[model samples]
Target: MEQLAEKSKKREFVKHPGLGETGIFHTKADGDPLPDSQLLTFALAGNQNCGKTTLFNQLTGSNQRVGNFPGVTVDRKDGVIKGHANTLVTDLPGIYSMSPYSNEELVTRQFLLQDKPKGIINIVDATNIERNLYLTIQLMELNIPMVLALNMMDEVRENGGSIHINEMENRLGIPVVPIAASKNEGIQELVDHAIHVAKNQERPGRMDFCDPDHDNGAVHRCLHAIIHLIEDHAKRAQIPLRFAASKVAEGDEEILKALNLNQNELELLGHIIQQMEDERGLDHGAAIADMRFKFIKEICDATVVKPKESKEYARSVAIDNVLTGKYTAIPAFVGIMSLVFWLTFGVIGTWLADGLDLGITWLSELVDLGLTAYGINPVVHSLIIDGIFAGVGSVLSFLPIIVTLFFFLSILEDSGYMARVAFVMDKLLRKIGLSGRSIVPMLIGFGCSVPGVMASRTLPSERDRKMTILLTPFMSCSAKLPIYALFTAAFFPRYGALVMIGLYFTGIVTGVVFALLLKGTMFKGEPVPFVMELPNYRMPGFKNVWQLLWDKAKDFITRAFTVIFVATIIIWFLQYFDPRLNAVSDSQDSLLALVSGIIAPIFVPLGFGDWRISTALITGFMAKESVVSTLTVLLGGSTASLSTMFTPFSAIVFLVFTLLYTPCVAAIASVRRELGGKWAVGVAVMQCVIAWVVALFVNLLGIMMGWV
Candidate 1:
């Protein structure tokens, strides 16, 4: 009877899977002690042009951000592996070492020690093994379990070098995985092995400190002394003894600060380091680094195997030579960018917009037919067809253009050429106190300023990030393209395409000039160094490209429906309510006209101070697209019929104002969120003042020359 009762009770206690144990597999029955498995946080670290991010993205999928260059990843990035649920990979700022060489290095070291990730996924460029392994050795000393992912394996094999993973594993006492990150080759296995090592399924061994008897004896001795010192310090600090010790031996400043070393110990350590440097004719810190590389070379020699030939490897080498060529790079970059914009605006964009316009017209007719069939009154019919369909639907009719433009940009970014563009543009950008990475947000700004402003969150420094966000609105958004197209076609039909291109470039120049002026006066700061990971060229996945297009297109359409939808209604009311009854005669009696008239005197020097132009500027704060809508309402028709849009002076003045005015409300809110209350207020006022001044200057010059 007792056994029967026990069996019955046990039958009710069958274990569940997900809540059962801590590891990848279940280890015990219900109500057992929690397992020892943990979420292994691994940071992918490497150098510029080393494919570090490609490897990171390959491991993490699309679960990462393309942040600013040189310390943009000011915080840790965590992404869960699809296959290994317990593993969380972190993509750290690419750095040459864990030492506090720059802001980027500081971020990387701080996360490794302070944040205490489970393991370090040190990505090394196989083609540049000699240089890359320098960072690998520094990581090894941190005493954290690490896996060296030899990324760009194809490049290495093509460059006539081989990495023996088994030999390296045995020598370093850690797992070493070879992968071509861009090709998505060997990524799954790499993540699996990383998880295994992180969860203690496989454990890393110690790095070989180098043989002591050769001419490099002093190098070995310095490393030995540093290791012992670190171990002793770790014991008192009560941290992870191995990582803590390695950091101390490596002379990590953050670690020293964390330890709160006494003056005497600090003085003694300094004296020891000085003495070592004097006696060995080498810095103790540098000597230890050399020993690690020497050890890495020895291990690499024994383990790696290579085939007789690698065609992919050869192609990568050939392309790098041409792409990075001193004379060829810039022209190539400019030509490509120009082509993309030309095709975007002149060919693909127009075709898509026309097609969608036809569709929207057809839809409007269908709605009209339904209303007539119901015998709706004329006022009701006009409200349904003219107000809703003609007004709102007209704005929404250009969805195809937005979709096509986004698709082109998405492909460029995913193909890894976007980084190349940044690299080539770095020389020019640095002159203006901006890094090459600023181009990413600028490109995004062309789509919409809201996202462009948000993209600045990736910038490493608060000042630079704010500056980039503030100026991004100057980029000519896709909505502005139609305005440019209309004016150019009406005024300079033969040169419409060229004039449109010129307007876009004008925005670029203004942004650059403004950034320089701000840096020189209001936002002075040290020039942040430029270091970027140039991923190997790879064929972008069709699925990835399509998904990006869909997301961006959907966002554009959603905005048109919500923010633009509400703004249109508000604008209609402003046009409808005319206390003076003057709008019906001169189209300026409406409330919008009253507001514009009040601001007209301020724009008198620009010569074109009509209430219509003034009201467009006023409504622009809601959204740039609203500028077109307000102008259409004021003129009582489409801008496609306007003749003034094409004069050189008027075009110049218009572009200047468009580039400098206050950004949309959403962007202003983001700025407030990033910069806090007072600074946001400051940005709004400063931008408006700047816009008025520049636009006035151009307008006055045009009138004096009798060109307007």
Candidate 2:
């Protein structure tokens, strides 16, 4: 330690590089050029629920994170292959086709074209090869060096199906490696094949999908004509000629815009396409689709052994009869979610939190004793026992409640039940001007509104995305659970589960009402057509579920220590000292109390006019978790003390207010990112106004009914 400190003592300031003086840094020996800044990356592209993420995790080990839904990988994540430090693999959002109907397709397609990755790793579910390979065909058209990871091959074999690997490889003109990503089977060979193919710069060799004999040579003639005409344009735009031609044939506007064809060239292209459509007896788009499907059919006929429907699939169908049948699905969804809340708040999570709270109380007493015995400074001693422990410790006990709630949510998601929820809710959601896809972001909102807002990107239409973004914060995120858990435990212990479920129901009901209001006002158009494929129900992967749970728990604990910890210190200092920075005899005389008192009148109609609760609500703009911790500090060190502050009626009103209010600063910033500054500000102000009005009405109704 002394030697390290002595060495640091010899350090001196260096000149800034911006001043044309080189800073103290390593310089290249000789005239060797600097290495390329871009890492060698392989795009991991695949359909939803085809084990693309699992393969990414296996390849990257601890370097990946996962979101809940299959089709909702709203962000692009990249990681280094475990053994290949010089190479990177990007896990793009799960996409079915390169068409621009949705965000995933646009993102994956744009990343492939624009980012210029070295290669592509396309994962296809071997059990569903025919459908999966439709995407495979589209990806091949990108003309990038590509390898196909045929995932879930073990399942294919178990279900009595097989593939002629060599024949498939020959037909597709790319390396095909069968991998069971879930089982870690065939991973290393897959890695070697991927690395080799990427290193070789080997693009797909087959571009001729046109069957000149079958289409009367009409479609083939059109594609060839378009390719030759726009060959220079494709080269200028840096688009693969084959890919650009096919997109032009399909009337892809984005590609057409990028190619920037002149009026004369456009007229010639349209004439060619019209002639092909007339000869092929289909529209231009349909004719192009027919051509590709014909090619896909030939490949399947030659290389795939169709599986007899597996028992797992049969089971999924039988379960769907009950869970997804028209009459049963909604009731089933309601019952299941209610049961989850009950288990989390009424039983498992509650028991765990009680035990943890007891432990924290004991530790706090021990620390209190030691500090008093040491003759610590009185104000400092109070801060230790009351500020840190009472504030942070109280909120920490509710960690299990958040984890437990997400545990069941993660199960629903991983088991493919959530997709069914979107399907069942589609008919109802459309009436409110949102699509079935909007339900996903809202469901994800229960965990945290930031990801929920991000998840809105997966929606197909701008109107749906904006409306969903505005309503996601009304879902009562898990961060707000600490507030509900603390309040219900203090005031409604016997019916705590009922209160918890009621709160969730209230958030949903509120969002629905807001969605309706939005439909009639800012957004009047119908939701974009909802199209989703429900993956066959299967047992949730234990590792996938556990990893999600671990991530959620770790994130909550981290916030408690960092964001909440700092907020506690600032809050304690504010509530301890007066305007002049002198110690106050009573908390009501402190700076926070004086400032919050002025704002307390705003909540007078909602029945919570106390400066302390108002102050916690203000700090809640920082993080919802700060509410419980702040209340714990301001009221007293004990839950029992908290119970004395609010009457039952007022407590219920407070819960309603918190349930419907705007989310924390992080979530608002996410809204800003997804929408814009105006929408973010509008959502914040609108939600607060709604919360106050609803809370006021509840208080008024209670007083009229003599319940207050």
Candidate 3:
């Protein structure tokens, strides 16, 4: 270890891909010239599936949350390095090119242009350099000081391809590093180089833009001329005016409108393009892209080498077949989901919660004993032990259940099966006017609506983002999980798993159907094209999995103690201070009871009109998990013995209401913020009405048929 440290100290290595040296980084011995207090931001940019996200996690660690850009649904992630202080990393949405054809690309471009981070860490999958380099070339054009981290080198070596790092570096005038992010190789060096570059220890040169010879081509002249014209007209735009001019010369419709060029100017530009095409005998866009590829190919050819056979390559191919192939993949996908849910809510979750509930019960008893021994006021003691502790802590004690669920989800994500699920389900989702990728945000919604709605930021289109946010609340969140678990355990002991699965699917199917109807009218738009990168899978790392589990558990615990704690206090006030309840009224004569009773009639068609359930649904707006807490408070005891608490009809009605209800206030605020006031109001109203009708219909049908 000492020798390795010493070796790292002496060598001043830049990232070199060909020699299997991406960078020479200092793993230890910090507090040098670079101030420990300064935050270093690394922006990871690459084409879709270039292993950029994988590498980002490997470098900074996976203590992150999925979020959306303000006013947009694009996923925005920011994380601090666990081992390295003063280093912050952001995983930008993947983009095919920095051409801004989609929201992800635009978000990435906007961040790069405006945020101006310390340095850009551009990851390129070594195996597919040709396709990946298109984005790399665009990044070079951005003029951001960058370090090229070439990832997935193992795949390249197996595919009869070799790249010379030194030669490519000499050619592109930027440092290049080769790494296998999945295997956790060369990560230290990557970070060290990042620190060095960020600190100005070494500087990257300006990219040399090549003026390829297109001898006397009229299209080339006209394109250049039109570019100059735009530059002359919009001097104040300060917008990659050159790139804008190039797109206009190629007749990009979006760009044309964005720049607001009228028909006469557009016609003149088109005529110029035609003239250039006649002379060059090539399409302008095609010609430009082809030239970029040629440059990348030449660089790769000079430096890297391929091997005939490699175990990693063979394994990647075999796994891809089983995980993504049509016939077996679909069943595998369903089985995986079933197993995860079953484990989370049935076996692992229930057992953990039961154990914790026992502890809470014991703790409450201990508190009560102390209160009784001291001759404390009975009312004060009851409020402290039962209402506060039992009410709040009991609901909060489910942290183990929530954490275990997120652990499994994080493992699946790390293994890359999540992408395959989307790939497999795309066709089915399209039938319902949704995309398979929509599952991610909805699945997240199950945990918490805030992050779930925030996860919609990864969607590439505005319409899709809006639809996802609007419908995600339909999924029974973790808070609703307890309600279902309580009722299922109570009424359908033998078929608890099956009943829970039905509720989940009800939420899913309703969301899909709602999406179809929604798109057919308001927020009408065609299903955007689906393109996602499925990264190479790896054995799940125990450390990464543990970190993810703890992170998720920590979030639940924090909210329970803070948000839910405060919410419980407010609820206590509402129930206790009701005019009727304060006036020595019977339990049924409370002001809240009367208020709920007024709304109860509206739900009578659904068969469960006790007003208690109505109150639970209304409280769900604060946070879904609060639903279970509210129910526990109203029921006045442990949910462990729910068999006597609710009838089968009431359980079914409860599950339906839980599944279809509107999202929490936080989620609604996010939607209103992202989609604006008009659409936000529409979404909230639509969700409430749909949830009421669906719950009512389910309840009525069960009563009419005597099934409940």
Candidate 4:
């Protein structure tokens, strides 16, 4: 261990001629330093919901960052493996193939081809090994060193199935590790094997899943001819010969372009592909899929033992009978979400938040007394007590609600109920010009809109991607939880959970209404059909649930200290000064009030016309959480004073506006990157217009019903 540490230290220090003793070397274009030789990188690839992310989180723990692949909005998660010094693991976006049919597949393929990671960790779902191995064959053709992690082996074993791991490893010519990632079982073994494979420069010995020269059909003949034709070119391009050959046979335009094939070569390739299609009675793509699956079946037949009846599978079926039923699915989904909300807002979360608020109040008073005794300047006291503490502390007090909500959401995701929700919503989502796949991003939006908007990249169609991005903000992310908690606590404490559910329902309804309007006019197109695998349900691990809760708490606290802290200072400065930079005795005479007053009258019809309310809304564009913090600062952190600003009807209207209005600047930036600048601007304008009109109608309705 000491020798390895010494070697790592030596590798970390690289001598540059112009910069002596420098520990890092920067690339000229991006100035990002490359990892040293001692730092090995392994790509983790697998199908969606195949325990891949669970394995990744176990391997990397908290040492991960969410980034983007070059020129793509898809998430690129990279992390340093636990207990494996100088080894980095990248969790590729979940994909079922390497065919570039979708952005995720393309990104994963391009990263492997371009970045050339040292090894690949192909995690397969053990319970459904046959289907998952289709991707395994494709990854093997990459010719990189790889380890097959047969994940969820515990579940498979529990259900009376068994895999001969050693036999499977021998057949596949790669290391196979049986693991239950959720249980943190066999993770260390998996990581150790992965490191050994990477360091030894081990490559898969059995790359040909289907014999190219065999006289299976014309498809075999065509693949053989293409491999021979492209062997030299593939070698020169540093691509795996068999992989390039298969892609060429399948008529992948990207691979053809990358190969820089001549015109005559292209024509020859096309003739071969067409000949195979004509003779075999199958298209090139279909023929390739058929051959791959046939190979997978042979391997599975030899090494896997399946029970006629699987208890887990039977249970899942029983649950899905009702959960995915035509009549019960939607209602079940609503009931499930309502239960989540009740737990978060009405019971556990509300109690925790109340305790936190009281603690913060006590701390603030103690600090105030100390400041007063110390004879601190009044201006400084006001800035610390009212500006920073009032603003940031108000947001922080709702951390329990955010954490609790995400905890339950994580449980739903881990237990596989969320996947069923997507399946159930497919029919309804299709009517809005989106596939059920868009629900994944929408559900993520309920946690945070930035990632929600980015998640839209998973949609295969460009129109669906843009439409999903535009509508995701209407899902009401956790950042707005503080706003809801504050208002409900002050005005509607008795119905906190119901009001919270209503806000979410309002957001969904608003999004659906706009989706219909947009589909009928601007972005008219039929959504592509959704296809996804639903993993068998399992009990969510307590450790995994606790980690997710910690992550939410950490993120919320980090934002409070950073974005919210800086924003609070800026807002305080604006409210504390006049145009001439003179101190203002009255905030209404200050710069913030002056600026907000310009837009205050516009919200009069929606019921929130106060300059302070307008100011809070404006700050909300910076971050939705800022709405609560800004209001807290303006109202002097008194719930009683804040409560007087609105009656129940106006509060409902305000909540409706908040729910449907434009997302934060960060989300808009994500939209701009995913869609375009014009679309981003259009979404902001359209959401504001929609929000205003909807709020006005809600207020008028309330008046007519005599609720005000």
Highest TM-score: which candidate? 2
**Per-residue alpha-carbon lDDT of candidate 2 for residues 446-535, written as tens digits (9 for 90 to 100):** 889998899898887889889999988999898999999998988899998899888888888888998898899999998898877888
> Residue 301's C-alpha lDDT in candidate 3?
69
TM-score of every prediction relative to native: 0.80, 0.93, 0.84, 0.89
Candidate 1 structure quality by residue, lDDT tens digits, 526-604: 6566667665565665655776676766766776677666766666656656775433444456777777789877766
Estimate candidate 1's alpha-carbon lDDT, on a 0 to 1 scale: 0.65
Candidate 2 vs candidate 4, TM-score winner? 2
Q: On a 0 to 100 scale, what is the lDDT of residue 356 in model 4? A: 93
Hey, what RMSD does candidate 4 come out at?
8.6
Q: What is the C-alpha RMSD of each candidate to the true structure, in Å?
A: 8.5, 11.4, 7.2, 8.6
For each candidate in the order shown, give its overall lDDT on alpha carbons: 0.65, 0.84, 0.68, 0.81
* Residue 575 lDDT in candidate 4: 90
Model 3 segments more than 4 A misplaced: 1-42, 57-62, 65-90, 154-163, 180-185, 195-276, 307-323, 523-525, 573-586, 589-591, 640-645
Comparison by TM-score, 1 against 2, better one: 2
The clash tally of candidate 2 reads: 0
lDDT of 4: 0.81
Q: Which segments of model 2 are wrong by more than 4 Å?
A: 1-38, 62-71
Q: TM-score of model 2 relative to the true fold?
A: 0.93
Q: Return whichever of 2 and 3 wins on lDDT.
A: 2
